[model samples]
Target chain A: MTPPSRFDEPWQAQLFALTVAMSEAGHFTWARWAEAFGATLKAMGTDRLLDGGADYYAAWLTTLEGLLDRSGHAPVDEAAATKAAWERAYLATPHGQPVQLPG
Target chain B: MRRPFGRCILDSGFGAPHDAPMPHDHPDHPHSLLPSDPALRVKALETILVRKGLVDPAAMDEILDTYERKVGPHLGAKVVARAWSDPAFRDRLLADATAAIAELGISGRQGEHVVAVENTPDTHNMVVCTLCSCYPWPLLGIPPAWYKSDAYRARAVREPRKVLAEFGVSLPDGQKVRVWDSTAEVRYLVVPMRPEGSEGLDEAALSDLVSRDSMIGTGLAGASK
Candidate 1:
């Protein structure tokens, strides 16, 4: 069997690094991030078929968004709006093209 | 920070439940052609944080490079081999793992508090982070997906031998199985018993026998290359 990559996806690496960088930058302490992540894990429950799959990372994203919102670094609403803009921009961009956010 | 599943009191008008199934695997967009939902979401967050002067993309890139290239299980293997070769280092590792590991130039986040559990003839030690996937990232780098799985978190502490059997590790009945539950505050590294008939081998050769799972206590070290 093939070995698993350090991260399953590029996005996973991005999320992981962003969390570390933010914590190092003092947006939130690693302990606080751990607390938030643990709470998210508890809320998600341990009965799912997911094992560090999309569902797991979904929980991670949820925790990150929540932490940023609470810390006033990036409110959830603003992130959501920006995400929506990205979705619209991506859907409009043709296949095989980089999805650029509207200026 | 418990996020209520349906809608949070602090809803940001996104409307969807916080735990709603992610559209990261959307079928319409080919996996190779388009970025997944999570990727786009990350991009959005990074863009916003960068604009707000709260995050530096370059710094994030450097961190990613470090994890991807500079850190991994080999580092943990070096520690294990050293412990196998040097009794004083092994004692120091067991007594105060964080400081001992620092002596080897291996210390970083998620590894500030480490405890080395050595396997003996009568005992075997395994580790799991039931809360979250807390692991020694400085030595072991990113944890395997299975290490963070709900199945492992729920079962490793309940029936450790059974879980170990699933990983192809079946200990003798006389050997007691001890499972360690790691936390954000403390992580664990399992130093597997030195394989028999390897006294002639050098430290580097011994290190090659030490696999990632051996350090995590899920597998035995290889007898030879």
Candidate 2:
């Protein structure tokens, strides 16, 4: 999803851009994420699983991607691309890196 | 980067550049032997401590247990303390972070080009490592377990407002939330603004206003009621 036009801040725009890219790349599917996370948690033990709850499942997708990269399933070039996009946005900011606005 | 345990001791403290033998037997010792995995290294050290009867194994374990939590916040507190005391330095930091941090003599292998991002009234910034966990080691010591976790990486970019809510930070409906993903080439740190009540406070008191979460952009600087 392209982030809402209301994202006035530079960092917000960058994050919106990144999320859109990753989602388009099929990395943000909730179904695939839930399945993989459920299996991993089953192996980690029940008590540990209980502690993790929903947040654990969310983190698992990121872990799955890393594991895919490590195992050569995901291309290293993709990561490089994401890094490049972030750098471009970061350099434009006054702080010289992308940062979040405080409430 | 691989050095014998003995050589690591000597080199870590005081040793001539050419005095120690080459870290690797080969002509080019490209990779250091130290395990990159923090848990494995801790385990290896724990075994040595146990064999030597240096306190009980449980005592060493306890140290490792607490050691992980203490290191990051301690380093963060120091950075915030320095920033609060020096406005010129803080300006320099906002301009060219790597050099500004080096001014405090806190640069090394892991913190080559550390950048500091400031959050202001108009903007909010958050950081993530979508690929691998790249962090500012000199200022923050090490990335936390949650930081390295995959869920945080994905959700942070996808639904940052939701994630921040988990940390008890919520932006207004119209406010924008920006997230930066760090890599080996470029690393980032959040420089939260000085709080309102901190006007007359000294460096130490001001530093108390900064928290690890604030530096991560997951929390706000301390606000006096």
Candidate 3:
């Protein structure tokens, strides 16, 4: 019962949760999300980018995106577009406040 | 990216068979962490994952709530606290860490190969994955962003004392600093020394003093020196 909130930000917590949620809900059936993630990373042609290896959530997001798209749910680039919109919202939002996507 | 399971393809948590085929065309940026802007990419991925019925928001909320309410260093702290209080379990942990940790029902994937290294006043141990961010996820959960940094991965082994200094951990000249390099097969978790005057503290209270960085050997338990 010591203090929690080990995650530094809301987004990190979100990514972790999403992975667990999706996995638990029986969505990660066909392939190892990790392999799917590797496949996504491989197909994205970012072989040159991962040399430094700093981003974990980035991998998670890519895996999630790949999973959804591979499962025939999301269209390719939909995640990318959403990502851009969120960036705009985040840029516009004031500091110290939750970034909300503008309607 | 941090590895999932000893470089092996993970068992899809549930057993179902649907091709997780990815859509192509978002060409690589070739030099950055995210192929696109960080915030936008994360949000875009999250939104689409939910919208396309690939995952459920409610389950996601539950997972979020679990990490917020249940997971954290407390899990690791508790194990350390228990080991500190119970010598038998400590021995068990040292002898067979995976089984020792599972005794508390606190077991998961990355925990499969985790080895616990205790820090004594004479010997201080720190962990780093020179290859990738192979962390002990069962107890500590996901690693802090810094743990996954290339700077730490490369620097931790070359200059353990300097890294410890940057982390505000100054070991005496005579104190031996052991830097355990994590690999795909094994990861190390440092069990920091129990601070004095904590004898009266219960397991839960003792865990309160254990910080996440302490388990990683970057910080210490917040007990009076």
Which candidate gets the maximum lDDT versus the true structure?
A: 1
TM-score of each: 0.84, 0.49, 0.62
lDDT of model 2, residue A76: 48
Which has the better DockQ: candidate 1, or candidate 3? 1
TM-score of 3: 0.62
Model 2 residue runs over 4 Å out of place are: A1-103, B1-71, B223-225
Question: RMSD in angstroms, all models?
Answer: 8.8, 19.8, 11.7
Per-residue lDDT over B2-108 for candidate 3, one digit per residue giving the tens place of the 0 to 100 score = 11111101212211322332222323421112223544455566676766676777766656555556666778998999988999999999887888888998775
Ranking of models by TM-score:
1, 3, 2
The CA lDDT at A56 in model 2 is 39
TM-score of chain B of 3: 0.71
lDDT of 3 at B163: 88
Model 2's CAPRI class is: incorrect
Give per-residue CA lDDT, model 3, range A1-103, as digits (tens): 3344555444555566766666667766323655565454455434444432335556656677667777755656776667666656545544323345565
* Clash totals for all candidate models: 0, 15, 3
Per-residue error for B224 in candidate 2, Å, reads: 12
Whole-model lDDT values for every prediction: 0.79, 0.52, 0.66
Can you write out model 1's per-residue Cα lDDT over B1-225, one digit (the tens) per residue? 222211111212212325432334535754224356787778778878988988887778678767877889899999999999999999999999999989999887642598899999999999998888889898889888898888898899998999999989999999999999887778899999999888989999999999899888999998332
Error of 3 at B165 (Å): 1.5
